[model samples]
Target: MAKSSRKANSGAFSRRKLLQGASAGIAASLLTPSGSSWSQSAQSERGSASAQRLAAITPESLPKAWSREEIQRRWRAVRQKMKEAELDCLLVCQHHPGEMISERQDGDADIEYLTGISLPYKWVVLPIEGKVTAISTNQVKGAREEKLSQDRGIDVRIVDGPWSASIIDAMREASVAQGRIGVTDLADASRQAEGEVTYTTYDRVLKAFPQAKFQPASYLIDGVAALHSPEEIGVLEKTTQVGELGLQAMFEAARPGVVQRVVWLAMFNAMVNASGERPFSVSVRADGPGNSALNRPLEEVIRAGQVLSQECSGCVLGYGSQVNHSVVVGSPVPADWDAAAKDSLDTFEEMLAAIAPGKMVKEICAAYDRRLVARGEKPGALVIHSGGLGTLPRGGSAGAVGQIVLQAGMVFDVKPAFRLKTGGTAQFGDSVVVTENGARRLGRREMKVVKLS
Candidate 1:
């Protein structure tokens, strides 16, 4: 269940304050881990769980994605920010809809955050003083994408042409031919543009509208997309809950003689089918006396002396949470394996304890130092992370630039691992939402390993 754009446009807003239709391709890749982790010689993280209560409720079980009021509230907030910035229109170019797994920088999900519907590719035009509209050359599933946009009250119009022309159409529909335009590839302040709005898109848009003043608006868009509304928090909660199903599936199925891919598919399929999630991808790896290559698959086979770890995200309405855990396949546990897991688990707990509304991300990350140092260990690895609404920090903790304070509505995945004396990583993590009181655990996935029969 990947969180890429689905559904297409039927009869909606036209190019010039009228009605027309648009047309598609696959989606871009999702987030790529940056900074600290790649440099560390330690092991990586990703995985999921089982069935039971998860099947009882799902995104499909609930008909509505966001209330009309919720969408409007979001619009109003963006508009106000636009007014403050003196921007007449904000043009957003998101990746086309479809699942892809390139090693490069994946596209952003700002469009998904703004509109309930995620399209394959979009040239969304948001006006500060007029009607908000979106134009796309990428036609999604008409029945699904179109209906969702209509239901969400978004003035989305499908058009056929170059991606740049889609921007021209959306601008004209909103009657914004010339004004100050804020251009963003939907990246936050911390990272360079990774979405579809590359130099070509921007240059094309610039030539199409020479009269308009254009400026980098990532900071502005990030401002609006930064904090999570209560409704968003609730959506994340569901993703974490569903992630539990996949996590359970992984733990239950991880055993000697099991196919590694089958174990992954068990968790992957569980999240998609049971929770109605659109998972992008998951990483599963195993290590032991004879197994070592981190990214290579295990030939779909699990063995007794292996340590298996997985990193996965269960997404609900484009909101997702990560669950990372490692297990010893069977019996006579290897020396210090469980201890490494315990240390990571304890470090996660330390992060939670350090989280508060006024705390900086670095301060929250200090828990890694405290726990690791107490264990006579040092963390040269990234221990804590945060992400939501297509806004995820690459590498390190919440403060990629080192100034992010813990806000009540922020969601994060704390993956804390200790360097194993046996030459690998013992890692654990899960997604959580920050609360006024502290960090509220959204994922109920098992942190400690349990024996599987």
Candidate 2:
């Protein structure tokens, strides 16, 4: 969910302040990877003032249980795509941070997904016939240890100066500086449609390798990345559990007159304590049924009868899972709310029925629209989007990337929403994975709106 800003009183500390202070401790505990994977060199590097500052600028590499087999599987899949595309190499890069991790300016998913390094300012040059190389703005000593622990090998280097200059060096070292190279960015046609590579980087690459031909090949990565491996599926399943825990905590904390930030704090603690990573996928808003969706949590007090609609997510490693809930503050639950909940669930089931291997994504949207049409109700945007490494393959609708075929390993955060007759929105979402037979929901809770009394 996109974040919205609101003004708040920056005054004396309260329980909210205490809770906020404790969040750093919770984050440290949650991010401390299970074993001793950090190399002594990495620790020494971080010990320096300059190195520590550089580390602060880069995204932290979370503990991922991906095996050498999984890494090899990805390499093979990407190589095959290169062969099909007749490209000599791939310049897989992420130049900007996502909206979710804007505070940290975190790295994009493609860099982390392909190579295990998760630095915000990094680039990877993968050749069809040579070695894979990574260029980082800061040293990632733990990255080497983590990859070695998994028995995976990769060449990692630091960029002393210009990003494009370092990238050009990496390209030359891989022997693809002047080859027919394919360039990819953080963009995906399904959601973030704009390319992330800066004009400066592109221009320098072109200038350095005038003979080289470069083409947009984001599809090569996106196509292969759309499907998850068995290991990936397991990680996603656990992430969903973490998301559920956060949602439950948020719901339990919401009551009449409670500040929205208080509710957000409860959710933040629950997720971080569950070994999840930021940016925690969460959105909270307390409004009447007729109001527009609020993408961020406000400091307003919760009132009786206002609906608290929120989306909670848990991210483990780099995979994230989300679940949404709409709670009525003090209820005689409105009939409109009741009807919307039932409608969302019914439409979700319909979408699930259409989520089979070889089925186009449009079929899911069609199912959603059809169900609402039959209900004679106004339909909201189909809230189903691909759930995988960093915001790739956002929701596909009948009009957007709907032709993409469904596969067994593809995951989706499906939540069918509808507008209430009185004015607000009602929806329920759960992370689900497509199976050989059909689709299975990852959440353990019952699908319904909570009526707080």
Candidate 3:
């Protein structure tokens, strides 16, 4: 996350003086909104600042961008696996077939990773041994395909009307006569499935394609999820920086008599203005006691001496990074607050230390439980405390918060939190990469509670 500092206050000013001071600050090159202009000297200074910020992000430090050769190799691997599993072909849907709101479209991550196309109104049919074809809405013809397939050189077929005919035609062109065709859609089997052919989409694929087979494209999804290239890391780092800016704004807005939504709006505006991006999710909550730590920010009025927790995540180029921090308004923390924050920090450090490539997730969870027990605290049942970080495309469960084995190239948001018996809680999280030696924190700033008195 990015470092934050307080904006200097120009106090005891009359209305006229306040306006004059504002104009003077702009004229004197003391302040400039992000991406704004000033005198030539100020512009040069801002340019230097930009350069320094860019220099901090080492190009060689992040993972490599996926090459066409690499993508093709992985695709061939999946095709070979499909052949071994006796599956005819895999059908990946771009949008959800069901009209139900809960059954939304498939994640764009998997489709983009595979075809370099990241639209919701598209579909792809990757046969075991044939050309890959995409069926998309006619309106998106030329533009969407051109942008998505700029690198991979894949052509997307435009569908004028219903998707069923377009899908069937593509399947026939791939020579999928009577074999089972794997599909990502669960509701649209008859639309894509042909006579004497088994529909291999989701659970029913096995039953639909008895002679053929049904296999999920999970391995392909997992490969993309685990793989983190250099460009992706840069985007994620920027996202973390945006999150930090939001956190800082939250701290600044957390004062006595400020409504919760007002604080949220301030933080939201700060982040959007700073990065020109919106947070994936932003929530704020403040109360005295008997509240869940994950409380959503409501329209409740803020009172003096209340603890406010602000959690935010920014979406940059589709990837996201999240951070949460608690702030005190108009009062110093109680005696127990310091100890709880310290213990939370300690637990976070322990978790970070335990994170390494090749470590079993189960072992890490066990270690967390042991540490909490040693601290004379009840270890809440936490299945997974970390995960591979990236844009969540589709196929996997939405918000799949769970434990998985650590890999060398994977990035994780390692968060270890504990609730105090006194009805208060302490929490902190940071983004880290699992390297061959150990984990590295992307946000180098120290984690601490901000007490605004």
Q: Pick by TM-score: which candidate is best?
A: 2
Tens-place lDDT digits, model 2, residues 1-453:
111122122443322234335575754543342223223333342244532332231112223345666766798899999999989888877633244333223556777778643445367788896667777655554443333423456666667778888778877877775678888863543234687777888898889999899888888877888788877787677677777766656555666778887777666666655553553466677764211223355678977777777667776655677787776776545668777778777777778777889887777788677766776854435567667664456554645467677889888788777766545567777889999999998776666545554
Give the alpha carbon lDDT tens digit for every residue of 1-453 in model 3.
222121112343222233333333322232223232122332343345433453243212222233455456656766876777677887766432222211112344445556643344466778887677766675555452344454454547777775666666776677676786665533322112221122332334343334554444444444445656554455567667666656655654656776776666665555544444344446666643212323245577877666665446654543456666555565545456666667667766776787777776655555556756877866544423222122331111112222345677566565555555434455566666677888777654457655554
- By summed lDDT, which 10 consecutive residues of candidate 3 come out lowest? 393-402
Model 2, CA-based lDDT:
0.65
Better of 2 and 3 by lDDT: 2
RMSD of 2: 12.4
Higher-ranked by TM-score: 1 or 3:
1
- Predicted structure 3: lDDT: 0.52
Model 3 residue 230 lDDT score: 51
RMSD of each: 9.3, 12.4, 11.3
Residue-level lDDT tens digits of model 1 in 334-393: 688877778778888887787889887777777676766777765334655455653555
lDDT (CA) for every model shown?
0.60, 0.65, 0.52
